[model samples]
Target: MSFQAYLDNIQAKTGKSPSDFKALAEKMGFTLNGKIKPDVKATQITDWLKAEFDLGHGHAMAVYALLKGKKPD
Candidate 1:
């Protein structure tokens, strides 16, 4: 699936947009000022996404990509 498709599916499943995830990530100290913290690991974010949103590994990675400022490609 395309990156946007993964994000769309996540939103459809979790009722959360990327912006919403960013806010929550900030709250979780995974991010600050709209950027991921340097000390944060991908697994930390992915694990949270998986456990909280019931997302699979690929889907959780999509969110991690978003956090890292990746664009759809």
Candidate 2:
């Protein structure tokens, strides 16, 4: 799936947009101002998403990519 597709699937499943996830991540100290914090590991974010949102690894990684300013080709 494309990057946007992953994001869309996540939103469809979780009822949240990327902005919403960003805000929540900030609250969890995984991110700051829409960017990944220096000390935050991708696994930390993915693990939280898995536990809280039931997202699979791929979808969680999509969120990780977004945090790092990456996009699908």
The whole-model lDDT of each prediction reads 0.94, 0.89
Backbone clash total, candidate 2: 0
Query: Lowest-scoring 10 consecutive residues by lDDT in candidate 1?
Result: 64-73
Worst 10 residues of 2 by lDDT: 64-73
Query: What local lDDT does model 2 show for residue 28?
Result: 90
Q: Quote the RMSD, in angstroms, for model 2.
A: 1.4
Model 2, span 7-32: residue lDDT tens: 99999999989888889998998887
TM-score of 2: 0.91
What does the lDDT read for residue 9 in candidate 2?
93
Residues 1-73, candidate 1, lDDT per residue (tens digit)? Answer: 8999999999999999988998999999999998999999999999999999999999999999999998765
